[model samples]
Target: MASKNLENFLALMAKVKGMDPTSDASLDIMQDYVTPDMEFVQPPSFPHGGVHGGRDGWRHMAKTLNENWQLHISPDHMWDIPEEDVVVLYVNMEWTAQKTGRTVHYPTMELLRFKDGRIARAEIFPQDTHAVLETLNAHD
Candidate 1:
C-alpha cells in the first residue's frame, strides 16, 4: 500500500501534468501535501531556469515555463528514498512550441519531498540540457 505521502505525491504529479496545457495547473490539487510554509526549488536546467522559496514561488515558475514552452513531463522510473521523505524520479521531459512544431526531449532527475501527505518541495536536474536547448532553437 502506498503511504499517505506517496499517494499524495502521485496524485499531485498526475494532476499537475494534466493541467499544464490548459490551465495554470491543478498544482493546488494536492494542497494537503504542503505545509503552510513549504519551500520548493529547482536547478538551472529547467525551462523556467530554476527558482527558490515557497509554493507560490514554484507556481510562478511553472507559469513562466508555460510561457517559454509547452512542458510535457513523463515518468521513466522512480526510486523511493523513504528515510529522507524523498522520491528520486527519472523522467522524460519535452518542451514544444505550438506555433513552430519545434520540440526538445530529454531526461531529468526530480527530487521530490513530501510532508504531511503533501508535496512540500521539489527540484529538477536535467541530464541532457543540451538536447532541450537544441530543441528550443531548432525552428528558430
Candidate 2:
C-alpha cells in the first residue's frame, strides 16, 4: 500500500498531466495538493531554475517552462519514506523545444515533501544539464 502522501502526490501528477501549465485550472488543481507555502527548487542553470515559493510561485515556474518547452516526465521508480514524509521519484524527462522542435531526454530525481497530506516542497535534480542546454539551444 502506498502512503497517503504518496497517493496524493500521484493524484496530483495525474491531474496536471497534459494540462496547460499557465491556466487557472492548473492552479486550482495545485491548491488541492500543495501547501500554501510550497517551495519548488530547480537547477539554476536551467531556464526555469530558481527557488519558487508558495503555490503561486509554483505556477510561475510552470508557466515559464511551458512557454519554451513541452515537458513530459515519466516516473521510472518511486520510494516512499513515510517516516520522513517524503516521496522520491526517479524519472525520465523529455523536453521538446517549441521553437525548434528539438527534443532532449534525460533522467531526473525528484524529492517531494509532504505536510498535512499536501506537498510542501519539491526539488529536482537532472542527470545531464549540459545535454538539456544543448537541446534548448539547438537551431535545427
My TM-score estimates for the predictions, one after another, are 0.78, 0.89
lDDT of each: 0.69, 0.86
RMSD to the native, candidate 1?
2.7
| 4-56: candidate 2 lDDT, tens digit per residue | 99999888889988875446787788788889999999999888899999887
Q: Lowest summed lDDT over 10 consecutive residues: which window, candidate 1?
A: 21-30
Once superposed on the true structure, which residue ranges of model 2 sit more than 4 Å away at CA? 17-24
Using lDDT, give the best candidate's number.
Answer: 2
| Candidate with maximal TM-score | 2
Model 1: lDDT equals: 0.69
Against the true structure, candidate 1 reaches a TM-score of 0.78
